[model samples]
Target: MQTSVTFKNIDPSDHLKSYVQDKLNRFDRFLDNPAEASVVLSVEKFRHIAEVNITGDRLKINGREETNDMYSAIDMVMDKLEKQIKKNKEKIRERRGSRGAVKASPMVGFADTLAEEDAEGEIVVTTIDYKPMDAEEAVMQLDLIDDSFLVFTNAKTDEVNVVYRRNDGHYGLIQPIR
Candidate 1:
């Protein structure tokens, strides 16, 4: 992995640079191709902040952490980035591994009940052209769009699926089960 370390509000030190390089080397096992990592270390009053950005193999990951100790901050941020990479890798595997599996579709419909009500309160229905895509692709689409949820046909199972942003800043996938 190629790494660049930048210091802010602190003097540049070779020790810190070597420390970061050694730490980032551990991530090589998770990546198939060479990756570029940009790291920023800063100290503000009592807070020591660390930020990392990694890009490679059609993936970009970022993590930030702040702690009382600079070393601990780097360690924590790296941990966060590692978890994201692992999750993305699993998503890719799941998408490919299920390609040949057959699935049954479930019954789903939206009920439109028109009753006498105030003009101010009304339901607005919008039709969208949902394209067939894998779950990982659906996630990429969700990130590009401002919508909280996306509906698409699963490329592997030929069933409609919903990907939604959860309250915890994670994604949720909804699929029908028979």
Candidate 2:
């Protein structure tokens, strides 16, 4: 992976640049070929902040750390990035399942089959429950579970919604419309 290190409110140093590059290289295993990583180092009062941004195939991962020591901050940021990558991988796996097969079936036939199966199996054949909640509650649940996103039923619309944590330390919500 190619890396670019930028120093803000601080002079560029060879040691710091090399350290950032080395730490980011660890992500090479997670991506096919990372396009380029942008690392920003800045000093805020007594704290040194390190931010790493990586872009890959439809995936963008970012990590930031603030500490008194620049090297420690870099290390912490890299660790966070690794964790994010792992979480994303797990989510993708869960959605796709082990058998990565997509067979197109007519919606009408599929819905008919689903209704028949439900009637046959009074027992909950599949068990996934969604609670009615708002975006803030979904975010809290995500944080408590250490998951990237939480799926819940919207309290107002009674629709399924998803809330995820973004790289910029903000939340993103997705709602589907019929």
Candidate 3:
């Protein structure tokens, strides 16, 4: 896991950064390869705010917490992130158990619905918000929806790509030949 911490309205402290890193390290047991965490710690007049975004294992989870103490805020946010990770993992496990019934996580593109198919299997076009993100982000986006595939712009390549859930509980990517 890679972690980056930003401090706002507060002095940068090794102690604080280490604190956040230690807390996030515990999540390694729950995430797979290429996990990245972006943490922002800020202080207001009376509120210490922590914002965390974790991307890994085809999942993107964000948690924010505010408290009177910085440590408290970090703890609260970490707890929230943990719950989200567990809930998402549980949902995926359940879906995997009945793989045939739901082979793919939905083609989730910012919550847009998939195109409808006619009874005769005619194709229909559906418009979605295309965002530039990596393949892992695309897969994570797909995991949250009910569609089988997602079309997105690859942030690295700056080209359109398709990511779909496979029947074997994995993911497939389709890219254009340039």
lDDT leader: 3
TM-scores for the candidates = 0.56, 0.54, 0.56
Cα lDDT for residue 131, candidate 2 = 74
Deviating ranges (above 4 Å) for candidate 2: 98-178
Clashing pairs in 1: none
- Residues 11-32, candidate 1: write the lDDT tens digits: 9999989999998999999898
What's the C-alpha lDDT at position 2 in model 3?
A: 95
Q: How accurate is candidate 1 locally (lDDT)?
A: 0.83
The whole-model C-alpha lDDT of candidate 3 against the native structure comes to: 0.85
Q: Is candidate 1 or candidate 3 better by lDDT?
A: 3
By summed lDDT, the worst window of 10 consecutive residues in model 3 runs over: 101-110
Please give, for residues 64-177, the per-residue lDDT of candidate 3 as tens digits: 999999999999999999999989988886676466433333333544437655556666655766768889877866765646888889999999999999989799999999
Identify the runs in model 1 with alpha carbons over 4 angstroms from their true place: 100-178
lDDT of candidate 3 at residue 147, scale 0 to 100: 61
Clashing pairs in 3: 106-145, 106-146, 106-147, 107-147
State each model's C-alpha RMSD to the native.
11.7, 16.3, 15.5
